[model samples]
Structures are given as C-alpha cells and as structure tokens.
Target: MAAGIEHGRRSRPNIRIIAWAGAAALLLVPLVAMQVTQEVAWDVTDFAFFGGLLLSVGGAYELLVRASGNATYRAAAAIALAGVFLLVWVNAAVGIIGSEADNANLLFAGVIATGVAGACLARLQPRGMARALVATALAQALVGMVALMGRLGVMSSAWPGDIFAATGFFAGLWLLSAWLFGRAARA
Candidate 1:
C-alpha cells in the first residue's frame, strides 16, 4: 500500500473504464454496419449475444487476474483468456467442423466446458491452472481427433486437414497457456 497505490501496475487513469468502453465500441461496429448495408443484417439477438460475450470476458478478467502477480502470470492469464475467447467466438460463428449448424460442432463446446470445469477445480491457482490447461489442451485435441475419425465436416474443403489444423492451432494455444502458467508457478 505504498503511497496508497498498488505497485507493479502502471498508474494509468481510467484503464478499466477504457477497456469496458472499448468493448462497447466494438459492439457499435456491427450495429453501424447493419445500417450501412443490407448484407450485414444483424437482429437484436445477435447484439445481445455479442454484448453478453464481451461482458463475460471482461468480467472474467477482472475476477480471475491478480494485479499483484508477476508479468509471467499476467501474460499467462491473457493468453488463456484470448484463446478461450477466440475458441468460443469461432465455434459460435462458423464452427471448427462443417458449420455452425453441424451437430459435430457440439464437441468443441465440450472443450470449453472442460476448461471451465477444470479451472473451477483448480481454484485458479498457478500450479493447478497449469494442470487444468493441460487438460484443456488434451480436450481440444480430442475434439479434433474425434472429428477426424468420425469424418466430421467431410463436406467442407480439405476435410480432415482443416479439422486437424484448427484443432491443432487451438490445442497449441492451450499448451502455450499451460506452459506460461507453469512458468509463473515456478517463479
């Protein structure tokens, strides 16, 4: 409590406010685009969904991050959050499998569920987070393996390769997050 302010963090004014405002501004883009073109038609439900997602992401960051933690920890948290955010966004929008409408896409949902459940189990501790993220990486890869073996998204271009690539990319991100968390634990 030196100088009645937290150290390690830069004394930047309105950073949290700016982050929330920026998130709100992003929602405006789609709203403005809908006004600009008929092709960009987005209903009220779409706006609600996106708004909810952004709020949840921001809220999660605020809740899970420890401001006093080391840079490695912060980086680990950011990487994990971004990875999860992109995973949910891509899965919801186009899906890693054939399309958003495909039943196979449901598998990706489990990957997210696994991570959330593991995070709960770990209580967000660094060592436990590292293990939880490893579990998440495995879950991500398992979804891809299932899609490959089950011939999911066969109608899509490059079939198995796309599944492999997408799943591999996400799994790699999870593994990297896990590695970072592990390093943070060590430090």
Candidate 2:
C-alpha cells in the first residue's frame, strides 16, 4: 500500500485461467472443423504444436506480469509476445512471403531469433527492451528485403504487394512495442 504498486499479483490467476482456456478453446476450433470438412485436416502434431505455442505465450505473459508492475512495461511485453505468436502462427499456417512451404518464409525465423537474442542481451529491462524491439523490427524488414530482392519463394498466385504489406505490418508492430518500452523507460 506504499506507492506505485500494480495489481499484477492479483491478476496472475486471472491471466493463467485465460491462457489455459484460450489454448483449449483454440485447439478445439480446428478439431471441430476437421470433423465437418476435409479441408480442415490436421494431424496430431499440428495440435500439439499449436497447443504448446498457445500455452507458451500465456506463460510468457504470466512471467512478464510477475516481473514488472508498470502498466506500460506490461503492455510493451504483451505486444512483443503477441507479435511473436502471431508471426509464428501465420508463417506456419500460410507463410509470409509465399505459402507455408515457401523457402522465403523461413526467413521470418531471423526476426524471432533477433527478438529472443536481444531480449536476453537486454535482460528484459525497459530501455534495453526498446532496443531489442527495434532490432527485431530491423530483422523483420531485412527478411522482406532479402526475399523480395532474391525472388526466393514460390507463390500460388502472382505476387502482388503481399510480401511488402506483411513485412511492413510486422515491422510496425515491433516498432510499436519498442515505442511503448521507451515510454516505460522514461516513466
């Protein structure tokens, strides 16, 4: 009750519940669809992979809330985490540059690796986190540059601006997270 304490502790169980329920519910959606349509066919590995991914995201969120009380810090962390989650999901399911099997799409891993490495180097501090996110954004943009320049992947349809748009969107998210982390550091 002294000063500037967040209700993060109180929200811990709530987040855990949400994560758990979310993972189950999301996994169920595909399972249900599979029964109704052949188009939705998914193996056990797919279910396991996604189930693990959802839970991991939730766990990361829980840890972040436990580690920092600043709401801005929490928000920044959430953005970064969600960005990674969405990147992985979309890349695995549909591919970033072409399709899921596109060799160019594999480059997205660099963005993730940069984020993880930067986070480790920064030790998750607000200022360092900002830098990490910036690096992440750069990595994302670099992949786009590389893929587009090299014409690296096969596309089912003719390539439009999809590659440009996808990379830009993800890079923007990384920058947004970086900006929030910067604000948190200043605070």
Candidate 3:
C-alpha cells in the first residue's frame, strides 16, 4: 500500500509535465506554420496570439489543479483568466485594438494572467489538472471556431476578418487541448 502511494506521488509531476508539454506543442502549431510559410501566409502577431493562448491554457490547468488541492485559495485564478478573455473580446470588439495592429499590451496582459493562473494551479490541485486544462482549451477552440466561421464568410457583419483570424487560431489550440485532456483522462 505504501509503495503504491509512493508510486502515485512520483507519477503526478510526470503527468503534469506531459500535459504541459502537450499544451505547449498545441500552442506551437501556429508558430511553426507561420515559419514554414515564410511569414508570407501569417503575421508575427498571429504566432504571438497562439503563444498567449498556450500560456492561458497552461495557466488555467495549473490553477484548476491548485484549487482542487488547496480548497482555501479562493478560485480567483480561474476567474482572472476568464476576465482576460473577456477583456480581449471587448477590446477586439470596440476596435480599441485594430485587427491588423500588433498590440503587445494586450498580449502582455494575457501572458501575465496566464502566469498567475499557472502558479495558482501548481500550488493547488495537481491531480485533477486535466479537467482545467481541457476547459481552457475548449474555450480557446470555441473562439477559434467563431473566427473560422467568420473567415468562411459566415458572420460578415458581426465579426471582421481580424476577429475571425484570431478565433481560428484559438480554435486550433482548444481542439488540441481537448485531445490532450481526453487522452489524459482516459489514462
């Protein structure tokens, strides 16, 4: 019994690492695509968005895991990530951040939020981390789907090309997350 417990303890970190690595790989897809396309197909900001999305997803996973472990931490990390997503959506909607403009400020905010979320998760529920990771990834995927639909000229009036582009990128991230989470849950 003690050996079984000890073995379980040793495997937790590996699980987290694997999940993180999967998330990281999903995040890198756009970057790799852009590089391979010679930057002619996609802009640098496109890659940046994927990077930010990865950070946000990874952070959420960490936060959920942390919260699961330490019931005292007050689920603020997850809430904060939600807020960041809202901010991005609002800013993008109001035209405060142009579709084509490379806005580092927004990206920076996202990064910070992700970092906080990750730290919180690391401290909290490391075991149930997959659920949180999946949730974040799903959110991103939804955003991507909306964007893809727009790009396909589905919602021309409501979402502009830029919005569609952003959404499409996130959608890819989320899909990857879903796969990872599903796999981890099964294992």
Which predicted model would earn the best lDDT? 2
RMSD of each: 3.3, 4.1, 10.6
Native-to-model Cα distance after best TM-score fit, residue 47 in candidate 1, in Å: 0.8
Better of 2 and 3 by TM-score: 2
Output the worst ten-in-a-row residue range by lDDT, candidate 1: 1-10
TM-scores of all models?
Answer: 0.88, 0.87, 0.34
Residue lDDT tens for model 2, 113-170? 9998998898889999999999999999888888878886645474647778888889
**Candidate 1 residue-wise lDDT at 16:** 67
Backbone clashes for every candidate come to: 0, 0, 9
lDDT per residue, candidate 3, 1-187, as tens digits?
5643674564245666886788678766656776777744646775577567667656765756654443222233334344455446445434322432434225434433443464456443332333444455455444445445535333335545555555455444433443443443444
Model 2 vs. true fold: TM? 0.87
Residue 83's C-alpha lDDT in candidate 3?
A: 42
Ranking by lDDT: 2, 1, 3
| lDDT for model 3 | 0.48
Q: Give candidate 2 misplaced runs (Cα > 4 Å).
A: 1-13, 158-160
